[model samples]
Target: MQEYAVIVAGGSGSRMKSDIPKQFHTVNGLPVIMHTIRAFRNYSADLHIILVLPEIQFLFWENLCDTYQFKERYQLVSGGSTRFHSVKNGLSSIDAVEGYVAVHDGVRPVISKEVIAASFFTAAEFGSAVASVPLKESIRSIDPNLGNRALDRTHFRLVQTPQTFRLPWMLDAFSVDYQEHFTDCASVLEEKGYPIQLIDGAYENIKITTPEDLKWAETYLAL
Candidate 1:
């Protein structure tokens, strides 16, 4: 069986308040996306990486790769109008009959190799592995009739990426009509009656969406 990672990145830097896309932004002397790719590459040299980016950003990404001398190999695919569609496009490029694929956010550049390994191992054993973390702060829900009220934080987990699944399940799940509620790979798989096996994920696996996140990733890398 083979291993694959579909890295989806479509940041436009609206949150980061930059003219440059967040994925192309530099962190610790390397592009954020490069750190993300290296995280998985360090996990397994044989892991086949599938990079999903907007069609317009292909040349820009390539130029970054060249300027940085990024030698890691990855198959590039054009993203769709939405993140859901972008992920589906990435998954559709895989031709493997039997294997596991981990869908990850390319802006999350600090995912540990341990978590990446555990995702594949758990997915192979249980057919699905969705990385998540327990929340530390109190939370609440808001509605017109119900209004805001405190809820038990222990009952919920903050879902993170490398939402891994069997290759066949991934291909089949994305084949359905794109639903508005399909927020991530886990949602699509859950809709198809698959159990979501939650695994511990590091808080350091934060998505890089703002300047603070960039600074945090830089600090983490330096440590």
Candidate 2:
């Protein structure tokens, strides 16, 4: 069986307050998305990588690759309007009929090799695996009518990506119509009655969405 990592990057950088997309921003002198790609490349030299980006960003990416002299090999696919649609587009380009596919956030450049390896091996055994972390903050459920209500924070976990799944299972799940509620691959798999296996994720594996997140990523790089 083969392994593939589908990295979805479609940010407009509005939150990061940059003219460039957040994924293209430099962190520790390298593009954030390049760090993400290197993580997967280091994890499995044989693993096929697919980068999903908006069609308009292809030329920009190409220019950057040349400027940086980035010679890593990977396939590029055009993203769709939504994350769900973008992932579906990435999945469609996969040729492996039987294997594992990890749907990861392209901006999450700090993913550890341990988490990536664990998720892949665990998914091989369980058919589905999602990287997650325990919540550190107090929790509450808020309702427009009822205001707010306390809940057991211990029972909840902050879900992250590199949501690994058996290729066939994920391919079938993506075949369904897109739903606004499908925030991640785990949600899509859950909707199809698949049991989600939760694996511990790295705290540093934060999605780069804001300027603060970029700062944090820079801090992590220094550490």
Query: How many clashes (backbone N, Cα, C below 3 Å) per candidate?
Result: 0, 0
The alpha-carbon RMSD values of the candidates against the true structure, listed in the order shown, are: 0.9, 0.8
lDDT of each: 0.93, 0.94
**What is the per-residue lDDT of model 2 for residues 46-85, given as tens digits with 9 covering 90 to 100?**
9999999999999999999999999888999999999999
Name the lDDT of candidate 2. Answer: 0.94
Best by lDDT: 2
TM-score of 1: 0.98
Candidate 1 lDDT over 82-144, as tens digits, reads: 888999898788887789999999999999999999999999999999999999999999999
